[model samples]
Target: EKKDKKDKKEKKRSREENGAAPKCADEKPAKETRVEGAQAAGDVAARKAFLKEHRMTMEGNGVETFFPCYTFAEAKFPAQANEAIQNYAKPTPIQAVSWPVIRAGRDIIGVAETGSGKTMGFALPSLPHILGAKQKLPKVVVLAPTRELAMQTSVEYERLKVNQVCLYGGAPKGDQIKALRTNPDVVIATPGRLIDLCDSGLCDLSQVSYAVLDEADRMLDTGFEEPVRKILGMVNKKRQMLMFTATWPDSVERLASSFLRDPIKLTVGSTELTANVRVKQTVEMIQQYDKDKRLLALLKEYKVGDNSRVIIFVLYKKDAPKVEGLLKGRGYTVGALHGDSSQAMREATIAQFRKGEIPIMVATDVAARGLDIDDIEHVINYSMPLTIEDYIHRIGRTARAGKTGTAHSFFMHPADKNLGWHTAKVLRDAGQPVPPELEKYGPPAVKQVEKTCNISEMAPAPKITFDDSDSD
Candidate 1:
């Protein structure tokens, strides 16, 4: 017993010493600097200090409990990957962890929350393996919960300019099928359209050997389980599997155990804590009638300038276009994205945000999944998201690519008090500050939600500045 106890202690120490979490960068199409610490929703100065210290440590030591720099060559990636890495400083945390596993052709269940670099973590490693020399038969297949997540990952794959195809609902998939004829090594797609393609015999995922579930938790929460299971049936069971989420809920774990084999279970900060830390969180108790007024006041007070980009997330998709109209009427150059939006427009809005043409963005949960633009300084929770997972992905839009960002949520009705308090608790547990207003509100009883269809509308777009390198 004594020997066993000693061994256990040593093992625990080793795990703590080595079990650093994964991190990732923003899909900043622009030449923006990487974001470091999270936005300080409460203690801006302290968070800034933490970021500065963390940056110094990372720069000096070249490793972090959450993020560590890694080379593409070390990841066994193709030569072109080195150029992409050279363009950026270092691989974010997610890239460091997920890169090795995906590259090794192993199944993974990645449980870090957003802004932990989860997107790039999987993206960088997977692309090279799939886009390999000669007769790679759509070896990689990506499944996302929302159109936004699917499109964003597709955009990043395009930025990498790897031969890939993106398929999702909202637009005619003829173009996607045409791209597939290019014999793309990677396919980034939503569960819905992928299923349709599988059923119609337009694409063959039977040759697929690697798969990823981005924002896995949200996929389950947003009712994508059935579609995911059907899609899974289409792929090769022997393929490497990677499942990532902001947090590891029970459902997420069950799915991992079923899909991943002898898999490495990676848990970063708890889901609630991951996004809350970097967010400059704040809340002003107000009357229900005063909600909009209070939001405008907070925006005016914080005042994200023309230079910075912002995303405002709300519970209902109906509110996304409403708020977009409201802010646009107020003379803020704003646009909207949601489930109801066509795939084409969703891509257009994201492109607009990336090119710095539209600095302000308002949306429902569509923006929450994996919209990966960088330098998003503010994430305004116009109202509480439907669940904690939604909140995690929502605010994670900011403080990405190793840059600092702020996230603010407003609390109005007493019934809605738990939303703010829970968000605060998640922050406090992560060693982040919980403002006094959190305690002032106290715990809350749950309020019922209105039954609305999941699909929401997205805004149309002007032309964007980004381009791609097609293989000739």
Candidate 2:
């Protein structure tokens, strides 16, 4: 017995010296047990405390064995990937806990609001996971809702020295086919375009072992459910799936049950529809006809002509160009991002906005979901979105990367009354003052409106109709 114990100790030391990955205390299956550094078995109390402090609720078969990391060093990713992660001051709450679970080779369902550094949370783990696979066999595939988000995810993988090919609608298909011939390690694509390529026999997902569904809720909401399901069906059966969403809805729950196997659900904050607390929300009850003047006044009040960046969110594609023309006529350097813009135009506009050359951008909900520019100082809602969920995502564009921002909304009665109660609840939850005009649309006010209109109940809010042409 003494000789056997000595031999095991020497083996462990040798493995450590050679930088082999560590296994969880209670080992799982072959691919489902490797973690970064060995977690301290006695740190159960501290791990529980960390989860509680972040308001993170996690539950699954092997979730209790997971622990949180305060720094990237604890993640101990391969040296090539470690350098990029170390550049950040510290991991965001979602990234901190998700990395440990992901590195342990478990499928995870991350429920966190936008601008929570979710991209890096999943991107960082791809390095170590792909290192063990065959050379350029397409080990990883990330399905995003929009082309902008797909490109953003590709940029993250590029930073980690991972060769990637982006497949989206708008770009030249010939160029994409050529890149695919190179057998890139990663493919970040939109569902529709990816399916098209697969049907054409130019791309193969047979060897894809790591798959990610980024912005999955948006994919379902935008009428891409069939495409998403078809693409998932083509990938390897033994793959690990990772899904991240801003809200936890029944639709997402059903989809998760269908594809994921014994997954861990991690919710960083409340599952209710809530905007980022760092944003200061202000509602102005004004006339619909006077909105153009009010927008100009708000622009002057916020001094957007200065170095700060601002995004003006409109409701429709037709309105995006009009708003852009209005801002440009007033001598403001501006750009427009919508479904109507060509791929090159969208890319150039986003690049200029990121560089601060174009300080103001007129955009619709297409820019709302996963557009991650961290320096936006303000958000001006030119019109109320059809749903409160979209309103939260619009404002989420600002106040990113630990910075505070302001959001101004023009609320016109009869047009926006459907969202009055919903808007007030979001304001109250964030501790922002609720205006009396907007407050009257609460439950009691709903009754008042029903009584005056002589109706049994108010009609539900109008549903948002998305364009099916641009799947991204």
lDDT of 2 by residue, 229-312 (tens): 898899899988899877766545665666777777787777677878999999988897899999999899888868889999
TM-score against truth, every candidate = 0.74, 0.85
Tens digit of per-residue lDDT, candidate 1, span 379-470: 88888876666777777888776677787776666656657667666677656667676666566675666443211111121211111331
Index of the highest-lDDT prediction: 2
List of clashing residue pairs for candidate 2: none
